[model samples]
Target: MVAGATSQASAALRTYPIAPGVSVNVRSGPGTHFSIVRTLVAGASVPIYCQCPGETVSGTYGTTNLWDNIANGQFVSDAYVHTGSDGYVAPQCS
Candidate 1:
């Protein structure tokens, strides 16, 4: 029962698609000045755990200062993610 509940909750988390044909850089922090921790695979979809203001970037989605937190210490520019919204899609990072 507990496992089923956990699965349901995990499944409820929404994943947003990355820009097609682009392998986005995952940064340790919300800005480009932060070290690149990894590169997302092309066509990857990510669950935004939170969001925060960051360096303004221009990408397939246009320019924005929003950064999506996909994991602890892992962030990607929202400009490269297609969240279908021009604004915040998740809670702001604390």
Candidate 2:
């Protein structure tokens, strides 16, 4: 069975890349200082369970205070992610 399969299935919020051809780093935390857990390809869609404020990042879309929770303990800067809004589109991470 896949890890976090139930949670993944239940996640309704999705975010896409804001910049074309540029892969975004998925980190253990919400900042660039954190260790990179993986990389999400540009134009790839990721399920965002929630958001939280972290290191500010400026990207092609704009600056944002939100970081996307793409998986269990996995975060990516919201600045590079197009969530269809500038504000929090999902619940705040706990």
Candidate 3:
């Protein structure tokens, strides 16, 4: 009965619902160094096309904050977002 509810979807499009109490940050870039567009409340959802390139954590570099990819993280500010799984900023993304 409604198995894989989160994985189920219309046609071939599989939608991943926001995890319980999960927060997806809306960073400017793939990684840190970008400003936040805004914060989406829990239960809010967006169509995710591409995901931030997963990074390897290193003590010298820092924790694996994918948002750090913003502006190359060399000459730009980083934006951190904390929202429920389905929540995220989208103004700049639009």
**Positional deviation of 46 in candidate 3, in angstroms?**
1.5
Ranking by TM-score: 1, 2, 3
lDDT tens digits, residues 22-73, model 1? 9999999989999999999889999998899989999999999999999989
Best TM-score among the predictions, by candidate number: 1
**lDDT (Cα) of model 2:** 0.81
Worst 10 residues of 2 by lDDT: 9-18
Superposed model 3: Cα runs more than 4 Å off: 1-15, 54-94
Clashes of 2: 0
Residue 32 Cα positional deviation in candidate 2, in Å, after optimal superposition: 0.8
Residue 44 of model 2, lDDT score: 81
- Name the regions of candidate 1 deviating beyond 4 angstroms: 1-8
Instruction: Write down the TM-score of every candidate.
Output: 0.87, 0.80, 0.37
Candidate 3 structure, TM-score to reference: 0.37
C-alpha RMSD values across all candidates? 3.3, 5.6, 10.2
